[model samples]
Target: MSDNVLNQLRNKRNRPTVEPRQDALVPKVQPEPQTEEQNSPQETSPVPATDNPTATPADTIAELQAELEKYPETRRHSAIVLEKDLDQELTRFCKDRGITVEVFLEAAWTFANADNALLEKITTEAKRRYDQRKRVGQIKRLITMLSNSAK
Candidate 1:
């Protein structure tokens, strides 16, 4: 086996075990019950009144437009880091169709969100990949243990 393959196996064997979240396992604290005195109504400050009592529909639209201006239209980019071969395959896939990887991902997202069957198919594919990876990990662990014992 190559040095790289041996290094990878060693890294997996020495990987740290993740502990379960203590906060998640702990029970949530319950709020104390309010007594009659605590629940009793008390004098409170008056709430602020709307700035415009008789705002027109056009004014409301203008206000919404102004609010939207605060959050200017911007394109957000996300990335997925794939292994070397997978990365090359995805790049080739997009290149064959004369589209960028980002465009391909966006189109796939839109199609999956719109079509239930496509979404289900993608989910199944993901599950299958996860199961395959899990099995591979188990085999790697077994190989690591066997190698260590032989040493």
Candidate 2:
């Protein structure tokens, strides 16, 4: 029995252990959705960063809505999950200005998508946030492992 137990322990120690694949550690990247320009045949210059600096939010929203109507049903509906507090604040802000949250988000996307500088800023911020989240997750996993071992 002692020899059998020793053999079992030795076999377990000598067995090849599989480390996680490098690609598994990395996040899976989804292909970027094609933009309007990509879908169109003719190449056009990007929209000017700002057509009118003094344009009010309402004017911008109205213009965006009109522009959207030009295309024949190209828009697709998507849902986003926001924190409760942020959602409440956004709802109240839009309500105070007499604009729907959907319009506000659409206008923001249009403005951000048009400008190169804004796009760069967004990319940088997104990367920073992603890295921060990854680090937090790693730390949490380490703490969990340590606690389990202690138990």
Candidate 3:
């Protein structure tokens, strides 16, 4: 082998591999500042509170009644039944807690709406018991069959 050829081979083997530059791999992010005018209440027209401080309970009830009239009478009757039961439950719970029915109802609504795990657990337990009963029935049938075969 020629000296030049051997040197060339050695140089090729020893030379470090060049990789492609990756400056573009990292993105440049610039956060723009929010303007004072954009943050101002005037820029976003202050939403006039539709909450009427002066509206009496009677007025609120009348408005609700009007809204309820839009639905069928059967729906209203069902809603009344649900409301009465809710009220009764609230009253009972409130008496136990030494609090007012209204306060207890508000708390109970919050609690019931927050998590449905209790409901799910109850249903699951009921289903498990039903399945167990079915299994017991199958075993009883098997025993009955064995006894008949022996006779």
> Each candidate: what lDDT?
0.76, 0.77, 0.64
Candidate RMSDs in Å, in order, are: 22.0, 23.3, 24.1
Identify the leading candidate in terms of lDDT: 2
What is the lDDT, from 0 to 100, of the residue 146 in candidate 3? 100
Which candidate achieves the best TM-score against the true structure? 1
> Native-vs-model 2 lDDT?
0.77
In model 3, residue pairs whose N, Cα or C atoms come closer than 3 Å (at least 3 residues apart or on different chains), thus clashing, are: none
What digit string (tens of lDDT, one per residue) describes model 2 on residues 4-77? 99999999899788986643222333466788778767555454444654566666678778988998674567
Off by over 4 Å in 2: 1-103
**Comparison by TM-score, 1 against 2, better one:** 1
Candidate 2, pairs of clashing residues = none
Model 1 agreement with the true structure over 1-151: per-residue lDDT tens digits: 6999999998989978898763322233446678877977756535432356455556656866887999848587666756689889999999999998887887889889999998999999989988888898899999999999999
Number of clashes in every candidate structure?
0, 0, 0
Q: Model 3 over residues 5-109: C-alpha lDDT tens digits?
A: 999998989978799873332322335577976775544324332245355556657766887999756322222222457668867877987997545545665
